[model samples]
Target: MMSGEVVHTFGFTVYFVFALMFTWASHIQRTNPGAGWWALSISSAFFARLLYFALLYTGDTRLIITAYAFFIVLEKPLMLTGIVRFLNLPITTRWFWFIAALADLWLAIAWVGEFDGFTRIAGYSLINTSLLACAAWLIFRHHKVVPGLSLRIAALACLALAAHWLTAPVFIQLYPAWATTGFAVGTMLTLVQYLSLLTAVLSLFQKRLLESEARALDMAFLDPLTGLNNQRYMTTLFDQALLLATRPHHIVAIFYIDLDNFKPVNDKAGHAVGDEVLKAMAQRLKDCTRSTDICARVGGDEFVVIGTQFTREFQVEEMARKLLEHVLLPIEVGGYTFQLGASIGVSLYPEHGNSLTELVQCADKAMYHIKRNGKSGVAVYGGETAGGLGLREA
Candidate 1:
């Protein structure tokens, strides 16, 4: 069997390594308060163990022992605080002070009563057990919100550490010969807890990084003013839809919409009101199209709608009519009511051209046909133009 001195040396060495690792992590993740608190917790544990080990060689003095006890009691509260802060949980300052006071009172009672080493160990174990259990409970409760395998593993390690501490006193009382073995087991459990927590922290960092990247991609591809897909993204969608439309009967309709009298809204009502009018128009375009369709704001007063999986020409014509009707609806923004109209030109796949550039050009020509004949109408490529029922000014 190994001596108590050997076990203490090994445990303190492990604590020292973990403390350095946590300190480095805290520095790297300076924004995370939980990581800083965790560093402090491990550092406190290392200090307590180092002081105890030093006293073994030097004479054990009351002041030194009290300092060691103070650090030992301080470690668990710091760990609990780290867990609470890391998970972004709400905790009262008063509760933190209350826990710290309770721990201090227990340490004082043990010191003043001149408790034996075994009694001190048992009392401190119970307190540490309660704290570890609380930490485990908090992690488990929030596991769903912050999902990761590492988090669950960390919670389980905390629970196991709590159970080890809770049972240590009983095992030590019944089998004094196995006291060193109990200490060894505790050191192993502490090691597991530390590693698991480190992994959990890394997992959370990775999650944040992935979410940030996704948001960045959205900002790059989305239109800032209308919250619609931009021209570049729309082109990408058009290519993908072309690949899916392999059947000879499948028709993809590209509608190129040019707003009538939109510039006057910007000039008369101010750009702010014109922006609101554009947003309302974009929403109407979205409502008229199916989920499979792609709608985008391609220019200042121009939009594109791509409809896929259409088996007949009339379906495309019907969709074009719906879009023009919806765009012609009255828009009320900032207490000012405005009526707008649209001239939409449509071109079909295979008949117009294979590529997006070809289809858009064909659609644009068809739209100009409507503008020349009369405003507010839908025109089909290689076909006749339908004029608006009622034409209105800006």
Candidate 2:
């Protein structure tokens, strides 16, 4: 083998072996789908590049270069496709993928007859234009779905690859003396850039995995539907609130809210719309409470708010009014709006009970009374209230 051929073989073999190993690791990155696609797409580029170099080095100039050139054009398209899917493209547009794959095959076949570089140029134009369009659509339109750091790094790498190939014709014109140096420099720079990208992708994935694990751990004590602390979390938050209530100066008020007709919303809307409504309602509920007060989804369409350090019951009373106003607002689904009402029960800590269990029970019973009387009103625990008839257990 020629010295040039040996160098090409060595370089490409190293590149592809690394890429091959990365493929396995990328497949396992289910947590960060963006990183997975970024890795796989980049690995594809290296795999194609390795084969291209190997073919060129062995002097398989006719068929191999033809195949390699077709592959080179396919690279950007494939990479953008992966990125688009990762960033959450509408699944209904799967037709685009079929079209892209067909373009690759057509280009591969169009190069077979060697009818000049015209067909290759045409093929390259199709692939390049499509890739640019896809990339632009992904970055601009789907910005919300993609994480910031990964997007910037990945977009740079893709742009770099596209720019590198766009300027390949200029380099192809190098004089014999300048050719080797120019090619070596270009190759080394390209390798270093892509290698850096690979490492960045790996780092991004590791960080994502850690965050996912943390979220998973948090979810273990969280209610997924309402994005609230679960029963387990309630126990913990209550205990902490309990300690705060022990001081003679401190008072905590618990407001328990139950939906009047929430079952029909879920039953009719299907789980997806129900989920959306729950998430929407959750945001509204959180907005009504102070940050110092803890609000949690205690059950299906049931939420509990613990208001602490509020000087008077009227402060909690005002909060309850705002909570009702927000929850009563219409939630839209498929261009149609529906309303859900709330039944609120209020109980004060230390006054209601000294323990977490008793406080919750009192609040829960007070909530049931509001529901039993008429589902749209609030009930406060105390002899000063006219609606002591509204409380079942206070």
Candidate 3:
């Protein structure tokens, strides 16, 4: 069995180490809102342990006990609140504060007057276990959505911590002599729980890091204004679509679209309204395309659609019509209604050209044909016409 002072000092050291580690992690990852809450949780635990040691060896019983009461009431809730924040789940912090205040009031009134009773100890155990169990349930409920190994391990650790707290009261009641000894059941369980908790905290940090990296990758490939895949992503998709058009009669069609009268909207209203119109157009394009199709904003007011998995060639023309119907929908921005139009140039594999660049160039010329003749129309490239052979008015 360890000596009382040794066990207390060791536990304090562990808590302090984790507190600092969590604080540092939170500082570095300050962009994540949950990291701040997690840092507060671990820091609260450290202070609670510090007060426990002061009660044992240094401070006045009443003053130390009062400070402990306040700290203990805050500790478990802070930890649970951190878990809720980390999961991006909702929690009623007002209720937590109310309950903590009640617990503090009880401790001030009942436990501060006498230091020899087990009732206060039992109450503390029940309160701590309940809070821990609530946090464990919250974590476990998200397992289906999150399903990461770190998340699973953290949920299990929370359950173990809850169990340790719940069982502590029983041990205190059954073995009074041992409960008063150097290596009490409560102290041993707390040490184990803290070690498991440290592991859980590390897991949470790992998950956050992975999520941050994924968001960065997405931002790289996505257009912020239109929320569509950017040119770089579209190029990769274009190549994949070309490869998929391997079987006979399987065709890949490219539609190069340019919005008509878009600059006038920006000049008349403002850049903000122009941005809204772009977003609206992006959604319309997505709505018109098939799930297998890739629609991207390759440049300002310019979009591309890659149509694939089509056995019939005429389906490409129908897709072009649908795109016009959707993109021409009435858009309302800043209380002003506007109607936008598009000119599209179409190019098909094996008929227009085999390569992406040739297809794009053919489509560009066809689109310019529509723009030069009359805006708000679709033009298809074909031989003899070379630039554009077919036109459909919008």
lDDT, candidates in the order shown? 0.81, 0.64, 0.73
lDDT (Cα, tens digit) per residue for candidate 3, span 1-394: 6665666567667767767766665676443445556667656766766777768766465566456556766877776676667666766766666666677766766665674545655566667667777777886787543434545555666677678766655775687555445234444544454444455555666667899898997898888888888888887778788777888889999899999989989998999999999999999899888888898888889999988987886788888888887888889999878898999999888788987788888888778888998788888876444553554433
Per-model TM-score, in order, reads 0.85, 0.51, 0.64
Ranked candidates, highest TM-score first? 1, 3, 2
* Least well predicted 10-residue stretch by lDDT in candidate 1: 385-394
Against the hidden true structure, what lDDT does model 1 obtain? 0.81
Q: Which stretches of candidate 2 lie over 4 Å from their true place?
A: 1-11, 29-70, 87-145, 153-163, 166-172, 182-230, 242-248, 253-291, 295-307, 310-355, 358-394
Clashes by residue pair, model 3:
none
Better of 1 and 3 by TM-score: 1
Tell me which residue pairs clash in candidate 1: none
Q: On a 0 to 100 scale, what is the lDDT of residue 54 in model 2?
A: 58
**What is the C-alpha lDDT profile of model 1 across 1-394, one tens digit per residue?**
8887798799889988888877787787444677788888888878887787788666664555566667866888888888888888887535654675776787689788987766766776777788788878988888764566766777888899899878877887789878679778877877887887887777777777898898998888888889899998998899888865788799999999999989889988999999999999999999888888899999998999999989998988889888988988888898888888888988989887989998998898888878887879988888433752222111
Per-residue lDDT over 156-180 for candidate 2, one digit per residue giving the tens place of the 0 to 100 score: 5445545644555445444334434
Which residue pairs collide in model 2, if any?
none
Off by over 4 Å in 1: 1-6, 28-31, 59-68, 93-113, 383-394
